[model samples]
Target: MSDTTGGLLTIAALIILLAAVHKPFGDYMAHVFTSAKHWRVEKRIYRVLGVNADSEQSARSYTVSVLGFSLISIVVLFLILVGQKALPFDRGLPGMPWDMSLNTAVSFVTNTNWQSYSGESTLGFAAQAGGLVIQNFLSAAVGIAVAIALVRGFVRSRSGELGNFWVDLVRGTIRILLPLSFVAAILLVSQGVIQNFGDHTVHALTGGTQVIPGGPVASQESIKELGTNGGGFFNGNSSHPFENGTPFSNLIELFLLLVIPVSLTRTLGTMVGSRKQGYAILGAMTFMFGAALAVVTWAEAGMHSQAAQLAGGSMEGKETQFGSWASSLFATATTGTSTGAINSAHDSLSPTGGGTVLVNMMLGEVAPGGVGAGIYGILVMAVVTVFIAGLMVGRTPEILGKKIGTKEMTYVALYTLSVPAIILVGIGLAIALHGTPGYMNNPGSHGFSEVVYAFTSAANNNGSAFAGITVTSHFFQISLAAAMLLGRFIPIALVLGLAGSLAKQGKVPVTAGTLPTHTPLFASLLVGVILLVTGLTFFPALALGPLAEALS
Candidate 1:
């Protein structure tokens, strides 16, 4: 088959797989969360925390409580980073500089994971385990809670409230994420990914002390992918041997990043009482993800050919153990879900691969996007697309019995457009200022694309970087900080707004002429709509970057 045909088929197969697994996984989640069997676990946690597990608190009050706990965690994490040098199990190169510590804390908490410091030299074992790993769970829990709130909006009967945030947060973390992460972490450890309590090991080799990294790497590695928070315990991220030891482990990491996001669509389908609609969304996500994967893999492979002595380094910054295909696949997986871990430097990717990553992020990371964020983000676009399609067909738009009205569409459109607006404006400002003269590492067009990609990644909360760019300057700091803030919060606020509006609506009954969303037809349409919308918005910016690099 042609590459395009193969790509299409791969995507189709993935969708079929997701569709087939939806009911089973959805039932599993329901059983895990709502069943009486889990109540004792919940009670124990509440008892330790000294709070009422069954409090009749309002949703707003519960949200505040969740936020309060999160804030306390952040403070604790910050202190841990600041005091790493003096902490037990310290193998640290002093503690993190104050600015870097602040950035790291914010990065992980927001699930951005935009590291400004080298990981190996700076952090100790305690900081790695307590600070970063804990945030991995908390940040992912936040995403899951937000997603569940949105799901509740559709699932409720005449209720204007979309579940309590505190309850959802606790259940999502303690019940779903913790168990899966433990199993995955143990598997990683068995595969030779490291877990330890000691300082960095020093071995005498060639008369130089080689500092061997050690920590609870395997533990964090699991949630780093599973939670969709791709912050590396080491600076090398997934490329580090301690974090991802073998090819088998690498493949497992890739699938773990994908599984939850893929499975959540099933949860969505279950909550809405229609298996087919969930399948439709999964089909669309799989199509986009597979297409990007093929493009990236082919581009990386083409660049690897010795026959093409291209001057620019395509594989220079990549890890050898995981060659072109592995790097390409990981990059594809990372972008697909807003997880920003890199086994290969994105800047070193063939322009085509780089371009694909950019487009994936620009697509709202909703091809089974960021943790809970990805699903809700894609669903927003789905709502907009359905609304538009309904207008064209001259009918009122309804999804799983929920009416698509002005209020719903307004929130969806705002949420959809917010990141792009931030990205474009940030890029425009960076270029207009000409960047710092010394910070133009690649110079000319590639340099410009680096700045664009960084801002886009930060603003979109997708933390993978075009590594060639020097973003340490005051200008980049200010610009990217702005992007991160806007990127992280706007969609969340809009999702909450959408949930509120959705919760107030009464479910409409399906009619004979109601669209069957679960079929291949709607799935195809959803994929096309996502592409059309993202393509129109980002094609120009992308052409200037990777397209230019590839053609040149």
Candidate 2:
């Protein structure tokens, strides 16, 4: 098959596999969250934590629980990394620097996984498995818990409670993420992704010797992609052959990135009592994802850079061990979701190609966004779309039988506008501190794009970078940490509140003037709504960066 055909086929087959498992997986998720009975093991953990599994909490309480758990996690994890020299399996790596350790702690716990330090050299196997790996499961569980809480808001009426946060978190991890990750890890190991913790091995050669580092990689690799927490065990990320050993390993990682995020649409649909509602959201996400893939794939195929012009593509920084087709595919999948495990350096991508990645993240990563994040983020957009369309058609905006009122719209407005505010302001701060902390390797429009992409990645919690900027200074470590926290928890808190408001609301009967949100027309409008917000917010900065370079 042609390379283009192969790339397209890979995406198609991946989507098909997702669809094949969607109903079963999604339904299982719903059951896990909503079932009355808990497993004996889960019951034991709940008792130990002093959790009341039977009593659901209000949105405020749930939010607090999430925050409290995360804060404790951050402190605990920070200590683990900072004192790793004194811990077991130190592997001769000492304690990390305080600021970098804090940043790493906050990043992983928040599900951003934006590494300011290389994992292989900085973190030992014990820290990776105990601290980072465990957070991989918990952070993702937190996301699913929030999404399930929001779903409960729509599915339950006259009920002020969302759900028991402890229950949801436990069930999501044990029942959902753990099993899937076990299987994915095995597959990765079978394909030669490293699974052991043996130390560095030196192979003697005729002239010299080569040192190879090894750790418990495949276990961490599975959840890193599956949970949409894209921190790599190695600095090369998926590009490292040891992490992604073959073309099939590349495909496996790509599929893992997309599987949960996409199936989440079905999970949303199943929970809300209308499968069509979920399909509408899924349709909008798919359309946007496909559009992004097309642009990036096309742009990569074009010869925009001097080297690319000669080589017929920008092969630099790409995983040539596979092919450009696979790298392009990985780029599309990585950016489309908040998963930032790259098989290629996005900095070397053509202007349009890299800009597409920026645009995808700037749109709040809702093109089948991060694990539990995708469904809730797009649902908020749907609410905004319904409200606008309702205003235009001169009627009430109702979705899944709930009225979109001032309270609902208020939460939606806060959730939608907050990220851009964080992005624009964070960019301003970084640029003000430029020439030092925000140093860029490239100059002109391309350099500007690097700064823009970093804050965009942080504020949207995507965690991928253009890789041309120097961001290891105090300013970036602190500012980007702040961005990742707000970008993640703030919207989640608001979403739960909106869910709370919607849950307390009475289901209004469908009137003749109600906008049909499940139809293709509404799906189109939903896409428009998403673009409208992202475009209006980021267009000026984007134009100044990537667009300027492309035009010049």
Model 2 lDDT vs. the true structure? 0.87
| Per-prediction tally of clashes | 2, 0
Q: Kindly list the per-residue Cα lDDT of model 1 for residues 310-365, writing each as its tens digit.
A: 74435666776776667877899898898998888887676677888888888889
State the lDDT of candidate 2 residue by residue for 1-552, as single tens digits. 787788778778887888888888878777777789989999999999988789989988988999999999999999999999887787999998998888889999988888888888788889899999999999989988998888888888898899999999998899988998999999999888998777666757775766687888999999999999998999888888789998888888988888888888888888777789889888999999889988888888667666688877678888766566677778878877888888899898888888988999988999899888888898899999989988987877888889998889999999998999999998998778635444887888888888898888887778888876877888888999999888888998899899899989877877777778888898999999899989999999999999998888
Off by over 4 Å in 1: 1-23, 36-38, 47-52, 55-75, 199-205, 304-308, 311-314, 434-437
For model 1, the local distance difference test gives 0.77
| Most lDDT-accurate candidate | 2
Q: Candidate 2: which stretches are off by over 4 Å?
A: 204-206
The 0-to-1 C-alpha lDDT of every candidate, in the order given, reads 0.77, 0.87
lDDT over C-alpha atoms for residue 410 of model 1 = 87
